[model samples]
Target: MSTTTPGARIEVRGLTKRFGGFTAVDDLSFDVEPGRITGFLGPNGAGKTTTLRMVLGLVRATAGDATIGGVRYVDLPDPLRTVGAALEATNFHPGRSGRDHLRVLADAASVPTRRVDELLELTGIPAAARKRAGQYSMGMRQRLGLAAALLGDPHVLVLDEPTNGLDPEGIRWLRGFLRRLSAEGKTILVSSHLLREVEQTVDDVVIIANGRLVKAGTMADIKGSPGAVVRTSDRAALAGALRVADVTSIPGEDDTLIADTTDLRLVGDVALRAGLPVYGLEPKRADLEALFFQLTEGTNRNETAATAAPPEGDAVTAQEGANP
Candidate 1:
């Protein structure tokens, strides 16, 4: 059942989900290309999970469609072997040992038992394999959930907040692991509210707000719009000089000034002309967290938005699709 080919692309077109009067997802559209890790990011109530559930076919969309390899998730001949997903960490039976929990999923998917051990070791939880899931910490549960998701050796991975409980070391390990998976040509979509974490882990990003698409692009493309940070003892003098030179400047941290352009020399020259000594100047890139907040700021005031609901149907169980 190993269907691991060069990863397949994921497409969402005009995807929407309405619960009663509230629209949890609104005409959202994006693409997750093969051989890269795409971050699906939004604030807590920004419909990130709802969108993922629609992609997995766990929740019916009110409008539009989500496809994997150009086919709906339900239409896949062998879903587990084609797309592996871990949406939550607490989806296992508390009474079951970690290994036994994976064993059950392996049996359901008709995966070989040896593969279970392989995944256990792959996720770095072999030492906890004998412990009941109830005794495991949040990070350990995350590892177990990931191991279960990989039991079928799928090509595409859709993980929602996989790093929530990881310590710094665990987070670093997960980052390297995802990068390696992408290098192997797997299409990986990871949903996270942690901007710094996502910035380091993903090559592309699809950000949402008020259940609607806010932005989507490669990280480089998004952050390439450059700026510069300049520091000087005479901050007020530099500001006047920059204005005289037709360059705009804004106040920055530590009483420094932030200029919209990336050219540091122009700023330095401007300061020199004003007889202000240049203390420090450095190139600054757009901050992903700032952009995320900027885009999603007013979403909370919109009445059309709603918090993501737990997925419906057997496609996602508490013990199976716990996080998407």
Candidate 2:
């Protein structure tokens, strides 16, 4: 669903940011509505970070502008109280305890001190509230950073690759945390090039490639365009009958059909008439990874196909959807 909050609408009107001579965000324009999680996605060098910086006013836009509720981020009254951003956990001070860190930020922003413990406890870091930031684990540090962002009870959240480094459990926790925040009428714009990671977590997605906006819409809207997937009881029978289907699935145990058919009822009717018993009918929706590759697949985007760094290697790129 498109994010729809009464306030905190983030509009990027042709925001262009240049790094030296290169345009990082090339004529980029999109709206990040409030009250939903907007997954900011792209390849490594596709300019996700640069685009976020423009929206936050951390980097000057060489062309257009990004506004938070009709005003720039810096223009907001008590910016931190209105917008909560966590670009990196490492941005915190090492010597301070998690509680102290939040306290300091509250003091600086003139927010109530009572919010410090509440946020620490809310993020499940109450045990480590007194622990120094330098001693915290990656997960703990992330939680601490999140607590800091929530301290002001902000309306909009801007996070850059929030799940950058962590174990599987940590990733899961962060996903739920972000969703809960969005559910509470907070607009969340999380930046990450890893399409697969953000696919299940976000309500909407904005994909950029080669510093240009490629797609921006709800996760459902983007994946819906890719088509539909349906599963039934007869795999081989369905596959044989759907020889001309846009997408079909591999055979699993026990003769179950998994085909990327847009219409399930239609497929079932055809299968029933063809004498194939139907057991299960499910749709395997296209995720962010599949949709992302389709958008940036054949195009050259300055960065090579290396799996380690900038651009679409593996950090945020996956190759699939060629099967039938």
Candidate 3:
């Protein structure tokens, strides 16, 4: 059978979740397009997990709705086949073998038994599939959770911190695996703090802070244009020229200057007119880590407070034994 399944769009409309006086998610809104991988990002306790829980119907929202293909997760005809989720790697019965764990889930979801072995091999865990989950390392457990998520060949995937226990090689493998699933038209929303890895993996991003929407867009659009990095023998002259052109610049190591404007020609012309000796000039795009910090810096007050005393309902507990 062809693996290319149709994907569904995920829409969150004015979603809000409050636990007593503290708000976990505040009027957040974003869409995860079909056939694309969207990175759901934020710092620790920034409501990312809470939002995903609300989306998966594991937690109730105070107001608004989260939908997959315009239908709430609770109303899906077959949630297992429609949306596969692995919120955490530890959601397993410690006594059960890894293979048996997936088999139990597949049976509950009415998935074929052969597909369990298929996923075990596909996730590169067949060698240890018979080992008890209690004996599996964190990385091994992550692979097993992923295998469980794919048991029904779901059209949409929601993964939270999927790379937590992976090594470099496993992380690289997961990047390729997620890309392949996207190529097969599965809508994916991955929540992770690994900004560098997410940058290389996702096509779009939805960033939140302090339980509120901060930024959301395609990677290129949000990163915008590349800034100009220039090195000149005459630092003072270059700085003055940049000022005349209304462009701002910051000093870099080894006396290099990083200009804030995307227009290379403008910087070049100003420097040329000023008769500054230019050593090097190049465009530099802001990495995801820098951008994430810039966007979420001061908006994490609630996140900070939650670290000390989280509200009663703020903790993300798996309500049912089955994966949402």
Best by TM-score: 3
User: Which of 1 and 2 is the better model by TM-score?
Assistant: 1
Clashes of 1: 5
Q: What is the lDDT of residue 47 in candidate 3?
A: 92
| Error of model 3, residue 93, in angstroms | 1.4
After superposing candidate 1, which stretches have Cα over 4 Å from the reference? 1-4, 231-276, 299-324
- Model 3 earns a TM-score of 0.85
What would the C-alpha RMSD of candidate 2 be, to one decimal place? 9.4
How high a TM-score does candidate 1 get?
0.83
Candidate 3: stretches off by over 4 Å: 233-275, 306-322
Per-residue alpha-carbon lDDT of candidate 2 for residues 46-88, written as tens digits (9 for 90 to 100)? 8787677667766667788889889887666667667777777
lDDT score for candidate 3 against the true structure? 0.87
Worst 10 residues of 2 by lDDT: 315-324
lDDT of each residue in 1-324, candidate 1, tens digit only: 233358999999999887766777889999999999999988777888878888987777889999999998878887888899888898889999999999888887788899988888889999999999999999998888888878777889999899988999999999998888888889999998889989899999999887889899999987865778998888888888888888888898896888877789999888887888877899986789998888888636334443344345423543333222
* RMSD in Å for all candidates: 4.5, 9.4, 4.2
Cα lDDT tens digits, model 3, 26-58, are 999999998899999998888998899889988
In angstroms, the error of model 1 at 64 is 0.2
